[model samples]
Target: NNFIPFYFFVDVYHEGLQYYVIRSIGGNLILLLPVGLLFPLLFKKLNNVKRILLTGFFISLFIELAQLSISVYIRSVYRSFDVDDLILNTLGTVIGYWLFFILSMFYKRVTYRFKSNTSINIE
Candidate 1:
């Protein structure tokens, strides 16, 4: 909490565009994708969009806060806590949820078709 928070997109605006894209934006998104995909799978209650999104937001917020804590208390600047990272991480989770939903639908359809074909009629 003692760490200074950047309210604006200073990192992306002032830093190298390529670095921001590759490390900050894309990295955070990719890093949190598994959290999004697995949360609903592991916990049925999170299958809903609102719950999943909230969980994602809290998880990212926790990570950012933890990073800030380490920097402030432990005297380490291993990471930078930024709100943009939080937003991007949440978006990544949403994308993963959609990916899981699409894959699940495809799996259900294929299994249903297979069962329909294999089941025998007791005529």
Candidate 2:
């Protein structure tokens, strides 16, 4: 139950690719998207995509290693540690960085418009 590297995909070989997307890739990506989004928001220096991706990758790796350690020390196969998770998590961070950039751009435009429109006229 814990050491399934390709469990999501190989477990259901006849189930088509949908299983991989729904169970593995999509889930991993979604789980980490928030990390990507929040990191940039909290740390302005993480605005770069490369930096975010690297950070996300390291974070995912750390999680996987921790899971492995727990599984090895406490219980056998307690958590599934997969390499795919690292890739997906890093991708999620990149996506999150882009989302933040887009949202910030929109926010700036809106604010600029509102400020210009709200001018105080003193005759």
Q: Give the number of the best model, judged by TM-score.
A: 2
Considering only N, C-alpha and C atoms within 3 Å, which residue pairs clash in candidate 1?
none
lDDT per residue as tens, model 2, 4-92: 55555655655666655567778788877877788888988888888888889899989989888899898688886887787778788
For candidate 1, give the lDDT.
Answer: 0.79
Candidate 2: lDDT over CA atoms?
A: 0.80
Question: Scored by CA lDDT, what does every candidate get?
Answer: 0.79, 0.80
lDDT of 1 by residue, 14-118 (tens): 665656556666787887888778888899999977888888899999999888888889787867677777888898998888888888899999999999999
TM-score, each model? 0.82, 0.83
Q: Where in model 2 is the C-alpha error above 4 Å?
A: 1-17
Among all candidates shown, the one with the greatest lDDT: 2
Taking all chains together, the TM-score of candidate 1 against the true structure is 0.82
lDDT of 2 at 64: 88
